[model samples]
Target: MRCLYLWVIIALFLMTTCPSAHADEAVATQSFWAGLSTKAKFQGEVVSNLVGGLASGSVGNALFIGGFSWDSERAGEWHGGKVVINFLAVDTGNPEAYVGDIQGVSNLTTVDSLMRLYRLYYRQRWGQVTERLGLLNANDYFDNAGVACDLLNASFGIVPVLSQNLQGMPTYPFSSLGSMVALGGGDTTLQAGVFGADAVHPWQQPFSQGVLMML
Candidate 1:
């Protein structure tokens, strides 16, 4: 466990520092605009059962996220083209076990401790119209309310109607293969996509697993 933390820190340091290692001015100017981001958060909670819930216990956990984005136009390639990659790693521990509910007290909790590719997608835009494809989190495009982000409750992040009922409503920890298109910009935009129902194994039963369509 400590080794995992060490490696993740080292990897993040290398990613941020190595990109500018090239001293050649010409090479630097020609290279695409690559942006890197990393986040490390540690959270602890105490649950007191004054009534009939779960047991009164406490748990502590950590979450690490890293991401990179490249702009093609900056590299002298075609305009309106970009690529994004994201990775997520969570320390083992279920905060919900102390709360006795599945909705979850911590948004970072997953079925199991996991470190996987969270999102890898390509986006292209032509005027007000934009398109994206590959492993995606549906929450990024739909039901995304900026005002509710600061809340810690899992249900506050997304509506239960979709998260609980929608078979494969792509949310955190389980992005699935999908494609989306959007028109318009600013205050109003029309967007839609078809995503694989089985987010855990998107490749299995690709067609029969059902699909999630949002508009």
Candidate 2:
């Protein structure tokens, strides 16, 4: 957790240190903006609860998430820089369902939560290529692998394999580096690299593991 905090601090530092220039056009600029988004998710769990003698268990676990997003955009021309902060608190029937549950039980519970930040460093356009960089959300590319693959394979209507339940995924509340380049007049975008997963802790192992593939 301390390492993650340090990475976030570094990212903030870089954002502040980097030089920025406004475009030749004047437009509305907001130093800060606050908003909220709500999401509901369902998860199923099959676990064993240890007892003095034998054991007990349950299934059909569910989860709910409510998030708050804060964004700030610097005034610029067609391309501008931005920073975003996201926070999420989940309601699981049994907190133990999560790896770092508030409670020690490995049962179904609601104490698990996720937080992340999706920052935009800089954006520039040259002909057909538009490039962007900065701390970003892991979900921008990794959240639903199957869904992304499906989108890339839109010609066929086949749905890919998916896991019904998820746990221990890193809640980046702050990821370090990200860069993307678009091609063919906005028809496609190719992402190059990203950073910050190394700072994730064991509690966030699931999410961090997925980032390894991003490289």
Clashes of each: 0, 12
Off by over 4 Å in 1: 1-29, 33-52
Residues 66-118, candidate 2, lDDT per residue (tens digit)? 33333222222233333333333333344243333232332223344444333
Q: How does candidate 2 score on lDDT? A: 0.39
What TM-score would every model get versus the actual structure?
A: 0.75, 0.36
Q: CA RMSD for every model?
A: 14.0, 17.0
Give the alpha carbon lDDT tens digit for every residue of 62-177 in model 1: 66767777778767678898888888787756666667886667666667788888888999999999999989998888888777654366777777788878656678777889
RMSD of 2: 17.0
Error of 1 at 24 (Å): 11
Alpha carbon lDDT of residue 213, candidate 2?
A: 29
For model 1 the TM-score comes to 0.75
lDDT at position 37, candidate 1: 33
